[model samples]
Target: MMERKLVFGVAVGVAVGACVVAAVVVGRRVKSRSKWKRVVRVLEEFEVAGDTPVRRLRQVVDAMAVEMHAGLASEGGSKLKMLLTYVDNLPNGSEKGTFYALDLGGTNFRVLRVHLGGQRSLSLEHDVERQPIPEHLMTGTSEDLFDFIASSLKDFVEKADDPDQLVARRKELGFTFSFPVKHASASSGVLIKWTKGFSIEDMVGQDAAESLQQAIDRIGLDMRVSVLINDTLGTLAVGHYQDPDTVAAVIIGTGTNACYLERTDAIIKCQGLLTTSGSMVINMEWGNFWTSHLPRTTYDIDLDVDSPNPNEQGFEKMISGMYLGDIVRRVILRISQESDVLGPASTRLLMPFILRTPSMAAMHEDSSPDLTEVARTLEDILEITDTPLKVRKLVVKICDIVTRRAARLAAAGIVGILKKIGRDGSNGIAGGRSRTDIKLRRTVAIEGSLYTSYTMFREYLHEALVEILGEETAPHVILKATEDGSGIGAALLAASYSS
Candidate 1:
């Protein structure tokens, strides 16, 4: 009996020891889980659900309208530099002829020849050649850069047909200078500043059209720059040519900006400006637009601080494709630092723009049950390994939150434009007017890779527009994708402004 008692005691002690061990293990896991939960809570703060509710969006709309008015009121009255594009007339599909467009927006410049057919029955023919701007030339003298462009144009023109034969006609070219410019006329503008990583010191304050023309002359090319326009105006021009109802244009790729047709009388700064159409395309330069109403997060603030142009392009930093992926990276990096779910802090995550917007889009779009693409992106971009499915899901949620916020904010901006034009409400620009009195359809011409290439981004933007505009009024507002509008629209402008 005594021996049996001893064995039973020994077994009881072993069971107690196992229980203690299990408790310790469970406690550690619970603590780890709690840490992850904290990370999730931090991420949730970045969400737009509470930050950009419908009420807040309405406020954004109001603010946007006010800013538009302020910007149009004077040169420096608001953050929005409502620069005049001097494009008094948009293409109306009556243009008939072969025109050339030279696009110098980014690292590559495209030379295009477009054949326009008049009215509804005319067909369009275009041949485009893209050439990479030499790296040295980007930072070289303005003359050198323009010379290179002129030489390329000459070569392309010679290849197309006999240059001498065209000498009698003197081919027309539309120049799309994507940077900020102070327009002197439809065919000329002075460069205000260069953006998008371009740092040509000599280009500022110079006449961009004149420089290009001088280069063309130096190369003995018989092409004249008939219209000097920006990419947003080009987009609006093309959209108008396709659908006359398109009143505004927005670009949402590396950067974001919008342009809209405004009554000449509304441009308070430039008095006595006369145009045949009685309206001119106003480059909103909305990238700089800001109000206290913007739902900015810590991540956004940090991004702005570190950006090359701090305190500038606040809206662009939040919504543009160039910065969205970095925003996701920053969120994930924060989580990794605060928890063990992502394993360890990665140097790759520390690198700026290491995770591009496309990768984020891919991960966000991963529909697999296991989220294989998310896991793969994590491993490839951040070198994060063995991320549990839950953690991978968390990463996806981060992407969704960032992208959704961007898309929704963009929608609000569009709504703001509509409001300013008196298209959002029933008043229709005239007080006491009924909805039925003026229910004309409105279309916003949008270009850039974010709206065209990113499927999820586009869907979210569309969904947000419907939510903001309501189902009844949403159908009246259309967001049309005008791909390569910058290039094609320039050609159309050349035709419209032809002498």
Candidate 2:
């Protein structure tokens, strides 16, 4: 009888243990499903930032305009003596010479040679080479990195097939120091803080031309750095040289900024520094503008939190090419975590920083008969497979919402600039009775990948501007998408400085 009791107790304990194990397995399955569900939902609803409370949108845009004006008026107003670059001179049709331009922007650098003819034919010839930046060099010493660039320049100069035909004896060249710099004149500037994932400690507070010139000389290249120009300034100069009516130039690539011709008298801080001509170029590092009226969606907030500099460049963080796709990724991740639609056991998205901007761009390029491209882009980027058709459609919709909002916001900012410049009228830049011409009228030069390469971004941006500026005035303001303006513009600036 005692042995029978002992066997029964043992059986009872075994049954309880089995029950606990089963419960745990079921619980884990539920939790895993729940987490993945959130991820899918977030991905599908990547429109978090686009759907920002409408009330906040107005506040963001208004503040943005105010900040835009402030930054433009005072270059290098930042603590680093990074004053606003004053490029008071514009190009006339008579700039004649053989010039070279070196463009050192983010991710890649390019070099070009051109022959400028006066108003006659304006003949131009160019050769360019591209090099990818090693990830390690980004965080390395300034001398190491600049020396690398110098070496590349040396090789380029050496390999020239016919130096006499392409370059002049003096070999003066324009350097498009795309990074922020403190400039005392058109031909000289000091390096300011480096942006775009570059963190070389020694480069800041140094003369950009001196470093580059030394490297050029060390490589046995006889080139004089005649001009040190910012990319935005280069864009404006080149655009204006091509078309005198181009009153403004903007770059919306990996970064965003604007440069416009302004009266030196308009700059209050440079009271004694004004040139005799009373006109100067003002570079509005408009990306730094902070505002509440601009669109501020949930995805934007998340991106800001994850970004190196948060609560800054609120507008740039939203519209620029570099961050646009990243924002979409965050939104998608949020949806996957909260929703149950994506099915269970898909934990690929739960990994941090899985989606990148380029991946988002790939997804955005999706335009299949059945929107299969959208799902394909996601799969290609994240290695996920077998996405449902419903989820794919939802993802496309999310991309549309975010991109449309970005276009609209960009349009509004352009309108604000036109308003500030007194070009919002029929009289145009002519100085007669058009001072109060609060009408949209002027040509703007736009340079950037997303603006130029995106499928419908330019059209959408035009539509958005028309919506805000009204139909009648919209025709007066022409937004021309210009290519390679920065490279040529830097050369134009060099010519101007030399003249």
Candidate 3:
């Protein structure tokens, strides 16, 4: 009797212990669900705040047009720096010559030579050589950097068709300096500041073209730096060379900027602004553009606050490839902090910019039923492990939301340019004619990894354009991607402005 009683007590204790363990497990699951709900609420709020409805996009378009007008009216009238390019005429395929181009924008620099065949030729023949800059030269003196560039150019020229022939005549070259520049002419610009890991202090506030020209002379290479342009102008030049309909160029790569042909009379900032064609390309430094109409979110505000150049390049922070990944990361970080859905290693999400745009794109584009890529990206980049399938879906949703906003905003920017120049279906500020009255075909040249590589981004951008312009007027507008636009276009401009 005693043995049986003892056995009963042990069984009861074991069963009770099991019950308690089961209840604890249930409590944990309930807590997890609550946390998940909180995260979803955050996401929902972000989505609502991030939405750029067609109505709102139109507002953005209008604001952009107004800002452009203000900037063109005076030097300091608005945030948009509508600087003049002094390019009176674009290359019309009548240019026939061998011209050289030097490209210095970021970590790497390139040299390209273009051979044009004139009116009878179908295409321009061009050759390009690219090399990485030594780490030390980026922080070195202005002379050191230019001398390295001049040396590289000299070697490339000697290896080409005729070293003696090249030396026989002064070669015209175009310098595509993709940095902050204040141009004095088509062929001359003062460096505003160095960016992209370059720390050449002496180059600031100096003539970029003159520096290159001096370097060319030092190497005994008789070359003239004919035009100083940014990558956007290069894209424009290349687009026009290929298609005369192209009037504007936009660069949406690691950075974003735009330039368009504007009427000389409209550039009121320059009292006597004159061009042979009555139009000159204006660099709208569109990155600095700002307006209350933009559907800004808390993410944008935080990003701007944390960035090196706060309150600057506001538009870029919201739409550029460089910041897109960071935005997604911030979203995920918020989720991780509020929930255990992503597992125990959530601390890794704290790193800033650890998630690159390319990685975010990979996750977004993953088409597998199980979303293996998304899972792998999370594990690899954020050290997040064993995330549920729904969590992966949530990540995809966040990427879509962020990317769609950027694409739509960029579309509004493009339409704004149209509105400013009377190319938008609607009449200009005066609103005299129907949007359909202007039937001329317009092409916008675009270059960059964002538009060319990201399929979804391109689709969203196109959809927004159609929505903003309506189906009737949207057909007349074309966004053309220019490959090697910067290098080849620079060479073409050199030929057009050749002495």
RMSD for all candidates, in order, please: 2.1, 7.9, 2.7
Q: What is candidate 2's TM-score against the reference? A: 0.79
Model with the higher lDDT, candidate 1 or 3: 3
The better candidate by TM-score, 1 or 3, is 1
User: Against the correct fold, how does model 3 do in TM-score?
Assistant: 0.93
Clashes of 3: 1
**Candidate 3 on 308-403: residue-level lDDT in tens?**
999999999888899999999998887777776777846668887899999999999999998999999998889998888999999999999999
Indicate the residue-level lDDT of 275 in model 3: 78
Model 1 lDDT per residue over 308-336, tens place:
88999888887899999999999888887
TM-score of each prediction? 0.95, 0.79, 0.93
Q: Order the numbered candidates by lDDT, best leading.
A: 3, 1, 2
Per lDDT, the best of the predicted structures is: 3
For model 1, the run of ten residues with the poorest summed lDDT = 425-434
Instruction: Give a tens-digit lDDT track for model 2, residues 274-366.
Output: 765578777777777655455566667777887788877776887787777766665566665566554453565655456655555556667
**Which whole-number lDDT from 0 to 100 does residue 147 have in model 3?**
94
